[model samples]
Target: MPPSLPFLLDRTDLHLAELHAARLDGDLVGVGDRFSPADIAGTVDLRGARELRALSLLPRLPVGLVVERRTAAWLHGAWAAPPGPLELCVRSDHRVRVVPDVAWSVRQAVLRPDELILVRGVLSTTPLRTALDLLRLPPDDRYDGRHRSAVITLLLMQTSGRERAAAALHRSPHLPHKQRALDRLAALSLR
Candidate 1:
């Protein structure tokens, strides 16, 4: 079995059939593809469970891809469920290629050095960067429906998440949707 952090079970810990059997046997309860011991399931923090669930995907994907956008927000304990087609980002100048036969969606983004953070050994965008990315997304885009809640969660999670994101938007060199991002941040701040 692969090394594990506290309160998480990965595929390497058991085969799918074995995991399901354990769940059916009332020994474990699953979140996405990972599981927590059944006895502690109700006591574990839901947000932390979600974070661990999202992190489980990391071992299944290639080594170099950085988690971003909705997925990162989920990792920050900002979403109720794991992201579908698991979103990831490759730096604009990075050579990482998307792996096939995996359930993930990849985008190329220009990330600043400060945008990344390592959580439980998983590399992902910081909540500020993740929220800013979602806020900067075109509001009219069809796929952005859940982005509002995710962005709100990301911003509210840290004491200065909103301020940091607002500052980043203000200092941006290219302003494709700077106003939109600021507006969204302001609206969330009022609530």
Candidate 2:
């Protein structure tokens, strides 16, 4: 098994002695209040610790909101760039408001148990579902459905099998953007 990465914050010791110990051992460096790999100092650049930090904070987030869309893709390491803000999803029955730097999208239809997964110990949409959602996003400059087609296709192909991804889109007939996802999937499959 690979060695576990250092904790984003030392929870056990309130004073952060573990972080200090790591600093003494030359294993970690401090940047303001956060810590990063020792080689680079002055900033907390969490290149390898991103998943650990996200997973560590999962239990602390509000209930019923699973990470989704671009945030999920970034957590899955399928996206090249870091997401602008946290994207979370909740059922329409739940009244969640967008917070500063966090985007909360509500789903009219409830997500099935299988449609979500514990990725890196954090609840997030399954690979197939994430891809379909990406295809369903509005046509905006940042990630219009068309612009993300290639990334979504590759994400599905790598994280979930292409066959399974296609099947998921087929099964979700109620999705408002189901046809669009299907069309995108078809175009990608032909490549």
Candidate 3:
């Protein structure tokens, strides 16, 4: 067996010092600072806590929303220019109201509760919902025809994994929009 690596944080108490400092300040500081093993002294292991903090707090906040390519790009801070419109995918079971300032459209579908996951702090619709929603968007709402087609195709593939896309489509008296969504999905499949 290879020789065991030195327990730098455990042996040197460096992680404890940093946590104490951060707790006193009520914020993390020098989070990315590198310290040589020589900089720490004592018998204390705080590496696990340090690792947890590094894993949890330093990254971009997760947005609990079922997003498409455009929304994903925007959420990741990757877009240098304004996106034309925001397309959001939501479950047919949830009540959603779009805010006025956002230029957006919705694609509605059934999402299994088990598939929904928390992003950041909000609940996001599942991948299956994302795909079905893409299929339900109007052609005019999708500015780039090729990109739109690709998203729809991807959603259809996702749909195939679950069951026939048509299996979820049904007339809804409570949800007239769902009927429109089903019709749109059917129309797209034909083309």
Name the top TM-score candidate: 1
TM-scores of all models?
A: 0.77, 0.61, 0.37
Instruction: Please say which candidate is ahead in lDDT: 2 or 3.
Output: 2
lDDT of each: 0.75, 0.60, 0.42
Identify the superior model by TM-score, candidate 1 or candidate 3.
1
- Deviation (Å) of 133 in candidate 1: 1.0
Candidate 3 local lDDT, 1-191, one digit each (tens): 97632322221544777755643564432222222232222222343323322223223222333444444322222222224455455567766664443454456655567546444443444444444444455556653554345445445444363245446545224532465566555556423
Pairs that collide in candidate 2 are: none
1-191 per-residue lDDT for model 1 (tens digits): 98544566767877879888988999888765687778667675855665566556657566678888777877777766667878787888789866665688887888877889877667789888888878888756543547888887777777877777777887886867889888877877425
Error of 1 at 50 (Å): 6.5
Index of the highest-lDDT prediction? 1
Error (Å) of candidate 3 at residue 115 is 4.7
Instruction: Give me the runs in candidate 3 sitting further than 4 Å from their true place.
Output: 1-112, 115-123, 138-140, 143-148, 159-163, 171-173, 189-191
Per residue, candidate 2 scores C-alpha lDDT tens digits across 27-47 of 775432445556543343443
lDDT of 2: 0.60
